[model samples]
Target: MTVTASARAASPLLDLVRPARPTHVVDVGANPIDGDPPYRGMLAAGLCRVTGFEPQPDALDELKRRKGPHETYLPDALGDGGTHTLHVAATSGMTSLFRPDTNRLGLFNGFSEWGRVREEVQISTRRLDDVEEVDAFDLLKIDIQGAELMVFEGGRRKLAEAVAVHTEVSFVPLYENQPVFGDVDQELRGQGFIPHAFAAVKRWPIAPVVFGGDFRQARHQLLEADVVYVRDFGHPESMTDEQLKQLALVAHHVYDSTDLAYHCLSQLSLRGLAVPDAPNRFLAVLGSANRT
Candidate 1:
């Protein structure tokens, strides 16, 4: 599942239409356990720079060891800048600030074993706004198990300038007092971000029920998913020309949302802000990529 930048088709149009500066990305809870990130293509093309935060010692070590020149990794646990207990689970990916809800996890198969608490470590968190290393960024990608709301509440100032957000949203709360999808969605909307798409949708089968000889196969229970949100594209007049261009680059390079990228370019073109025929050139490049 390690997707490299080479997997994507080459497009010279991206080179011509990319922003003057590299897109800045801030990644919270950046554990490589999830495989390659969505911005891998941009990173490989030298079109973006990443600043990642990981609290776990082993995970932080791995990130630093393999980081690129433009990539920076910090060992800061990000939240509302308060002290909290980190519930280390049997599986690293399951570790979270909030304790696991064993009763609820038992309702689904495989999760109970994965979410079992192995240890608890007291730690201090740093608010995103307080981090001096992160001055400003164009995109934010966060996945901190269940404490996503705390970051949003404390990082409003930093998030205001971001063009897009890629965050993990839970349909069902696996941790005690965890905020679900609706909670995160409302907060992002209040911050002027609109839901764009769901990059991943995870489902788990109910316990003690086997479906078609596959015990791990899910029948109809939604667990969690990675959701992408972007600043209101419908009102291009409200956004700056730089914001529009950055959004187009993010949409095309990160999410492969060609239509959305084209719409962004189209708005810039109408205002005489973009290069001549930028939208059409984008479509042509996409068409050629698809054919190859």
Candidate 2:
């Protein structure tokens, strides 16, 4: 469920941890092919600001057309600051820097058709650190198909201050030379983040076979997922007070992980950084929300 202003208002715990400025979010591959983003609630509630990058012309136009006051959309391809050929797939969401691996995709249902390259465009890319408009942000939400590692490699300095990251990790390589989940995990962990939870998981059945007459339903074969990671929460001493506050807000508002939010509050209280009853009030707020 998208967390609304009423939800934020009801949570006295959120009030205690709310930062002076809105949470800043940097979205790479900000195409609207998918429905509302995970941070939609925070965006609607005026609790966050979004700076989105989409190189696809049609996608960029759509984003600009519906952009809100707190949103900024840019038409820049983000990578390792080098020119590369973008494989524009039949499905916009499938488009990526790497070409589709037809052999692997043919093994699954409906993927080969969708991953077919409709066009190939050569584009110059910008590194995240080189972008003058992009500064320190609280959250990083990226889904650039198979090129996520390029962003991470080029933006280490920019990501140092980030409190949380929501990224699409693939268990199976859908694109040629794609870095799978393990690769992304190692990089994120090196940057001081621990895997928190998966927001969504996708599965696909093998081609020429249907499960109970349903092609969409798969009993096994995990394909991809949107994984949420946060700055190492176990060590409160490593995070600043502001980082704790931002993380608490993202946990509660974006991911609905109230326990994680409460943990942040408890750590704050331990350091005399928050009210003594902050954690208790958070539980009370959660209880009230559940009842209603």
Candidate 3:
């Protein structure tokens, strides 16, 4: 799912009005396997400046060539500034910092061979607190396969600057000893990042078998999902107008979070910083789209 900038540019859904100040992002494990990453949308709108991290050499090279003026890709993985082995898989998307829980994964269909680790490469890991390019960022987007918690563990202090986090979380232990959804939720709550919304969920059938149009009986099991965490939603007044505006753009453009967009728009409007006619129109578009 390689996303070209041109293809994304064609989609004005994310080209919502830019904020007064740039929305900064600290993206960890920013491998572009999951289609065009949200940072691209934020970048195109000139609403964000991103400092991304990716250890995969090929992916890093590709990013290096295509990175925009507001983007920077570091070839370091986020961790305790130590040497770690990457569990490379048969497919690039399944690679992770943790070993695969092959037994549990083999119970499913397309996911059975997802964690076929082909190689293990030693890599250097650095903590986000040590990075000079990042003073603070509004969003902290991470997708380091199963090591999402480890990154946060290493940079708990730095996370205080983040208002929102969009990260991948496994509902089951797809990888051995990996933190599950509960673990992630607890950690984020401890950091003051409340569960905002689920951007995506990857599920597999309960059992691999032919069904005679009895899909409801077959049932499905949750595998992994992209989870969104946000700072106190009740305390929007604590945020400046520009920060609220940046959050609004991120909510609408990156997450397609119309509800959050409405919240931000409301706050901005109350402070006389509305984005022209965005609040009402965003609601209208969402209403019409969901109706069908």
What are the Cα lDDT values of the candidates?
0.87, 0.89, 0.75
Global lDDT for candidate 1? 0.87
The most accurate candidate by TM-score is 2
- Report the candidate with higher TM-score, 1 versus 3: 1
Q: Give candidate 2's error at residue 264 in angstroms.
A: 0.6
lDDT of 1 by residue, 191-227 (tens): 9899999999988888889888887899679999999
lDDT per residue, candidate 3, 78-127, as tens digits? 87778888899887888888887788767766555667888999887777
Give the top-scoring candidate (lDDT): 2
**10 residues in a row with least lDDT, candidate 3:** 10-19
- Each prediction's number of clashing residue pairs: 0, 0, 0
**Residue clash pairs of candidate 2:** none
lDDT of 2: 0.89
Write the residue-wise lDDT of candidate 2 on 229-265 in tens digits.
9999988889988889899998988999988999999
> Which residue pairs collide in model 1, if any?
none
Return the clash pairs for model 3, or none: none
User: Which whole-number lDDT from 0 to 100 does residue 90 have in model 2?
Assistant: 96
